[model samples]
Target: MDIVVFFVASGCAIASAIAVVAQKNPFVSALALLANLASLAALMLLLEAQFVAAAQIIVYAGAVMVMFLFVIAYVGPRGEIGGGVRKPWLVALSVFAALLIAVEVIVVVFGASLGAVASVDTDYGSPAAIGKALVTDYLLAFEVVSVILFMAAVAGVVFGTGGRPVRLSTEQVLAKEGESAVARRREASRAALDAARDSTTGESAR
Candidate 1:
């Protein structure tokens, strides 16, 4: 049953991965990626890495996929690729990349003599152990990743606004509306006063 489950997850993972690349619609492709992540998490669970599986589901499938979907929605159809004319250089580059991946897969499967999988302890994927490793051994790498993520967020904001700082705030918008209303009221009063003055002069002349 475990073997069957593993195979099923593996197949789903592969199929969803292909669909992620194949789908022209950005939203559909994001859904495919979510499925792929879900299947990968299943595979991780089968390997007895419960914490890793949970993290995979929560982090990649939950947070990352949600972010991707939000971006796709925010960007709308304009963010979709493959809708415009394909460039020759892009096509060539894609073909070359596919061929390179195929070669690497063939070499790994047929040429390389991979060793047996190593065994791990029961707590290998536990949160405590992982946290300890992160703070102790991988502390520098973890901090670096945080900094990179922060920079990425800053860059995203910069590019999202077309390199311009945010100019309008809630207070600014309200102030502008108030000024417009005041100006409109002043104009109305002036018009009313002019009409009253003209009527009084016409009566006096008569």
Candidate 2:
């Protein structure tokens, strides 16, 4: 049953991940990413890393996906973006370089004859156990991550406000009104002069 579940979840995750890249619409891609994350969480649950699974679902699939949806809606998929390194060859080269680095890292970490990874405790995946390690062993990294996330949230808020119409100050409003009034007065004066000239010409002709 566990094997069956793992295979199913793994397949779903892989499929969703591919769909995330395949979908042209960013919102649809985000939805695919959400599915991928959920499947990964399910796989984590099967591995007995319950806390990690919960965090994946709550933090990534829930919070991050919601933020992605909001940003996608705000920016809109149809918005035109100009000026970038848009060449297909450049993008393909970048992707290839990234894949190569990833492969190297994976090989170094997993293919090593003598692994440097310490074996975790049986209760490592438990909330209490993970929390203790987070506060004690990985405290600095955890705090740094928290700070980064806070900054990202602030950036998101700023970006969200970018599309909104800014309110004009009272002084700016007054200035605009003054300018329009002056233009209107100039227009009236021009019309009066034209009308008077026509009347004088008519009298002179008589």
Candidate 3:
């Protein structure tokens, strides 16, 4: 039963990973990533790392994926490229990747040693143990990750602005609208004057 569940989760993870890369739509890719994360969580659960599995689901599949979807929504999904294969380099890269995968498979099948599974303590992957390690041994790494996340949020906001002002005052918006209206009216009057002049010239010629 464990073997069956592991295979199923592994297959789902592989499929979802492929879908995440193959799909051109960012939104669909994000959904595939969520599926992949969920599959990974299942694998973690099978390993008896319940805390890790729950964190994977809550932090990655839930919170991170929600943020990804929101960003995709805000940026708007991009249309697929409308041309034939443009990059000749990608063909070579794909071939190289295929060969690498083949080598890995061969190594796993014959070159790998069959070793006994290692044993772990009952609390090895528990939340308590992880929390203790985080606060004691890995506190610097934890704080660093937090700072990196804060920086990433700041960077996202900056890039999303796309050189535009983040906020506009009501008066500024009204002024810009008024200027646009004036420009449109001016353009219309100029077009009308040109049409009238052309008609007058035609009449004189006749």
The per-candidate count of clashes, in order, stands at 0, 0, 0
Flag regions of model 3 displaced more than 4 Å.
77-84, 105-114, 165-206
Tell me, by lDDT, which candidate is best. Answer: 1
Q: Per-residue lDDT of 7-41 in model 3, one digit per residue for the tens?
A: 99999999999999778788888999999999999
Decreasing lDDT order of the candidates: 1, 3, 2
For model 3, what is the C-alpha lDDT against the true structure? Answer: 0.88
- What lDDT, from 0 to 1, does candidate 1 have? 0.88
After aligning candidate 2 to the native by TM-score, how far in Å is the CA of 182 from where it should be? 8.8
lDDT of 3 at 176: 75
Q: Report the lDDT tens digits of candidate 2 across residue range 1-206.
A: 99999999999999999998767778788899998998999999887899999999998977878987887887884632422456899899989999999899999977778745567767879999899999999999999999998998899789766876787765676687876766686799999999999999999999
Where model 1 places Cα greater than 4 Å from the true spot, the runs are: 84-93, 163-206
Over the stretch 43-122, how does candidate 1's per-residue lDDT look in tens digits? 99887878889999998987888998999998898877555656899989998999999999998898877778789988
Question: Between the candidate structures 1 and 2, which one is better when assessed by lDDT?
Answer: 1
Query: How many Å off is the CA of 58 in candidate 3?
Result: 0.8
The pairs that clash in candidate 3 are: none
